[model samples]
Target: MRMRKILPACVLSCCLTGLMAPAAFADGCPDQEIAVETLKMKRAEDSEKAGKLKEAFNAAKTVAWECLGNDAGKRREALIKRVGRTLGDQEEKQGRLKEAFDWYLAAGLEADADRVMLKRANAKPDDTNAVGNAIDHFKRRNNEARVREMRGIAARNVDKWLTAEDKAFAARKDSREELGKARDWVYYAEAGSGKVTERAEKRGDTLATDDARRSIENAIAYYQFADKPQKAKGVRDKARKLGDEHARKGENKLAVEFYSLAGDDAKAAALEKKSEAEKQKTESARQDKFKKDQQSLEKELGL
Candidate 1:
């Protein structure tokens, strides 16, 4: 009975040793499962760096699962780093810049993140977009030392440009105001001239009145300054009509002056011819009447 109990105890001890020896060995060194997972992860990262994306992805997946199963802390860290770098590379190649940046940052590689972000900023879609992207990247890296200075320079340039624009706008506004004042002056001057012309006409001095006539001429000049050529022409025509009427009244010198004032050279010449003919007729009539009277007197006296 004693031999039977000893034999059974020895067999049970051997079975226990068999189980505890492997556990001891595993505890003393790295676990075989973890080691295998680490090797696979390393191979995957190497392949990825060599531009073998598909192979890297497959190997990384396998290592990740194995590391999880083995509950290996160091191996898990390595796997995560490898997978993150591979994802970052793939995202960069595919033009997914933000995603690439996130993956590189997760892998604890800030330098890579910065490089990728700068690339994205450079690939901006429009003029206003690049500044926003560059700012974002610099902020992410905590690199604000020079960013503020750059921002200040940009602000200063904008302020200078805005100042110039404001000056130009003010100059344009002033010009427009001056033009408006000139137009108003022309309107009032024309109205005053019209009133003066009407008064002069009622007083029978429409053509002979120098002051009122001068006002009408000034009014036409002001209308031209106001860019109203049609209105100016109308006023000039009225002045010409009044002057022509004065010229036809047998006022020889006065008619010449009026016709000249009316700018009617042809009418003035005709009127001058008529005046000359009238003078000759008056002289001839006076001579004829004197001769007749003298002849009658001599007959009466029987001389």
Candidate 2:
């Protein structure tokens, strides 16, 4: 009985040792390039499954570059793509967006890379410094669509900052310095994204335009209430120009609002009158159309 137990134990130990031993490269490929690539690719997959991403990434880098050029049969291409995608996902989850983007690109996934970059820009939409950095990153990469989107985000963040600043200023009438700092952020938003304001206006987004106007009005109120008319001159000029531009476009109501903000009571009142007249004129035209339709129906029926 003892001899039988020892024989079984020795057999088990030999089997375990063989299984744990490093894999031989003899069965991989006859060519050196193929052999090296095959070995590294297998190692990469194993390391990744074992949660050793750093080792996986290093191994994958070698396989992704070297294997593609060596393997004419495209044997390792699928594994290389898989490794690149996996590394990108891991890096993105860790907030390493730049690395993730590069990995995705190397995987030949351009759309995935762009999406990751956009997410990076949107990650800190409410943070001025962070959003600014994201915008700069997109700009340097010549991503025009992403730059525009980032600018819109920056403008929105400025609005949020202005709202908080408004509450603080209201609570403390002596918070001129704080208000001035808030105005600087507003300026930064406009300066950082030259097209944001123009695009907002052209898009006819009522809420977006209102948000922008409110922020600018807050700045004007701050300077005017602080008895600094000279300092508010530039803002007043901008408001006046906006009003004139709206009036020329036949947006009399918006023009009136802007003129009022500029402290141009006369221009605002005149624009308001024009808007009322235009509304009445439009109503009258609708009524006339209704009457004409009724008369045509009566004539057709010989009523």
- Best TM-score goes to which candidate? 2
- Compose the digit string of candidate 1's lDDT tens values, residues 222-267: 4554455665566656667766666666556666654554567877
Which residue pairs collide, candidate 1?
none
Report clashes for each candidate as comma-separated counts.
0, 0
Q: Rate the local accuracy (lDDT) of all candidates.
A: 0.58, 0.66
Best by lDDT: 2
Collision count of model 2: 0
Give residue 164's error in model 2 in angstroms: 3.1
Indicate the residue-level lDDT of 91 in model 1. Answer: 95
The residue-by-residue lDDT of candidate 2 on 1-303, one tens digit each, is: 999999999999999999997644333433666666667878877887898866775677676444335552253455556777888998999999878988887776777877886777677655566566656766777887777777777666655555564565457423444444444455536642233233222222222233356655755655554455664675676788889998999878778888887889999998888788889999999999999999999999999
TM-score of 2: 0.39
TM-score for each candidate, following the candidate numbering: 0.30, 0.39
